[model samples]
Target chain A: MFERVLIVEDHESVSNSVKQALNDLGVDNPEHVSYCDYALSWIKKAIVTPQPYDLLITDLSFEEDQTVQQITDGVALIRAVREVQPDLKILVFTAEGRLEVIRPLIEKLGINAYVRKARRDTQELKAAFEAIANGRNYFPLQMKRSERNGHSFNFSTYDITIIRLLAEGKKQKDIPQCLQDNKITPSSLSSLEKRLNQIKDEFSFTTNEQLIAYCKDFKII
Target chain B: MFERVLIVEDHESVSNSVKQALNDLGVDNPEHVSYCDYALSWIKKAIVTPQPYDLLITDLSFEEDQTVQQITDGVALIRAVREVQPDLKILVFTAEGRLEVIRPLIEKLGINAYVRKARRDTQELKAAFEAIANGRNYFPLQMKRSERNGHSFNFSTYDITIIRLLAEGKKQKDIPQCLQDNKITPSSLSSLEKRLNQIKDEFSFTTNEQLIAYCKDFKII
Candidate 1:
């Protein structure tokens, strides 16, 4: 019954297509914000607005420097919106499929629905909207079978500590000192940097700077 | 507030302790079932009886044997229960921290709550029970940050093929031939074994056989 929808996505073409699709679904007053700040402003005004968006479809990734806070990623954006409007339904649309990466926020942030961005089918989003519209839930079906089976990743908590430090603009050589300062020296972090490099390669990046910049931009730091 | 809880956990001590903790929280009927079958039986019986258990606190690792149709290892259990009693609250007590692994179920399954197992405090189980009692959600606060930044480890279609061939007791030399036969070459599999070894070490295993055995046991194969 909720017709108004708001979308928080960085991809302009994709966002427009989704907006048009919702229009086809008879949803009017659908607003698309390309960044979290704009979406937050809309949500802040939603309390007094005559017509507040009933549904939200957001993407996890955002354009760099467009995000305000170091932690103001799309997931963070969703968390903020949840605080403002606990009753509003949200559906996440993302292409990132790492089961290990987003495991914790699924429950922690109180997301209403999730749709993996599929190139072949719009049915995933369609199904998600239908489920939430009926006051039911929608998520991937294979999660129960896969469970936590492959959810573990190579980077330990120490790696995150180092990555966060690096994102703070510390030098590559100073990383070892940083790890030592934090009292988390499993190995001399020259070795840790080596490990970090390995992680970056796994995700397909060549250098520490690129990885650090990527993490900072994504607010992983 | 509902008191009776069914615990579907594979680990013996964890299963026992969780039940004990629930009992300590003043829930008299905290039923604990280790295998998925036992858990399923209780769910089925509860459906017919109507005086069903109020909650399911499941470990994400429980898998039915190789032959059984893997309906819902962990999520399926909750789904099965929800199929019968759509309102029953479920709390996932898990070590899994991946987006793909956790996102779909939390959004789709209508899980009442979750408590990250690794961050289990001295009174964490009691806290989880109490949260459920109050009709509120309880997921760990810190889990979201680490889980988001964590690199998602996905075994590629090629990775799956290699692991499967390894599981079938094929020797190391057979991998290149196997890949060649399949019209794909993964360069040298010597490094493949090294990566597999690293994976095995992370998951706590000794040999390829041990890794294969774990796969069989965990239903990852």
Candidate 2:
């Protein structure tokens, strides 16, 4: 059902293979580019065209080149493109399989799918495309568990603000004053202590430092 | 003081620039290669030669190619080279700047220095080489603090073995029995508890989970 797609990959062999796979999946004229700058330009071009690209499949890391570039990595490119077209469906293709590293991108960027580059990954890629076309998010089963657990526990604005401040090296005693200055609700020292303790208990964390590290790993802060 | 050094980097531009930097530092005959396999073979040749390479500089990630390789990443190459030449000094030059990732290479593999690939990194690389030549280990100042704190506390065999088991997903209650079966000393329940508590207190950790994560970050286990 997909009409248009754009692939951003630095490796020539990888880009060609991905293009071939897209062809076999019945998507014709699937455009590809090796640089983030060119990919951005293509996205911009599609925005004013009669029929815009429906999906963007991109690699995360790009090798360096002689020509200077404003966008060096895919994350920065995603941020830039999102500013121009917020509703574009995105699928990330990367060799980086670390959950902690990629979780923040999915949560913050609202990317539609992530397909790891591995053996039999082409099948996984096709499945991801179909899922995205059906308006559903797709992640590997192992990562699905982490995604569910990450989202199951809801974090309030107050919790996020407190964690962010803690990560910035703010002292517990000084946090109440900082929160009050920002007009954050329930800024009392006792209230803050209770909230932190509750969060620690929920996560089975025994100390504030552990809570901070856990929040960092999950990209909650 | 360095006579011969080998550079292992995949990117031609990066390899050339690093080679230029080495030349500037008055180190002639500085050889460079784009693959880990070539680097390993060169090390083996040097090992049998009358004059062996005095230092090794390697990047962690190499771009994947159509031609499959026996040794793909730099870490595996480091391990292989270390096995053959235990006394060889190694300097890791990588874009991977995270302390959690690089700390293990320093503590477990005994790498001489780590230089992040960033602005003015050529100067940093030169400094790393000089420091290693002077019989000193060089890590960024931020990492130096953690390294000092990590080394300040002494870990006994009992402490390490317990933490290693815990990291392997062993429950606290099940640990004493496991250790006893292995004929480890201080296998009493009370002694195990005391040792764990002492370790936690030393690191200001409040739970066994926190202790395990901390040990993992510092590569203590």
Best by TM-score: 2
Q: Residues A1-221, candidate 1, lDDT per residue (tens digit)?
A: 67678888765435655665676677776788777878877877985788777888888876554246443577888888888888778888876555544555577776777766542225567777788888887877645544544423455677777766654445567667766776776658468767786787676664454454444433354
**Candidate 1 lDDT tens digits, B1-221:** 66567888755435545655666677787787766667878887876675877788886765444545445478767777777778778888765665556777778887866665542332665776688789887765655665655545555676667767764546667678878887865647776777777776676554454444434433355
lDDT of 2 by residue, A63-168 (tens): 6756577898999888888988889999998776656557878899988999887544667788898899898989877565445545456788889888767655
True contacts kept of each: 0.00, 0.00
- How much lDDT does candidate 2 score? 0.78
TM-score for candidate 2: 0.47
Q: Give me the runs in candidate 1 sitting further than 4 Å from their true place.
A: A65-72, A142-154, A162-176, A183-221, B1-221
Docking class of 1: incorrect
DockQ of each: 0.01, 0.06
Candidate 2 segments exceeding 4 Å error:
A1-4, A9-38, A49-54, A59-89, A94-112, A117-119, A129-143, A147-152, B1-221
Instruction: Give candidate 1's error at residue A82 in angstroms.
Output: 1.8
The lowest-lDDT stretch of 10 consecutive residues in candidate 2 chain B is B142-151
lDDT of 2 at B96: 74
Q: Cα-based RMSD of the predictions, in order? A: 19.8, 11.0
Q: Which pairs of residues collide in model 2?
A: none
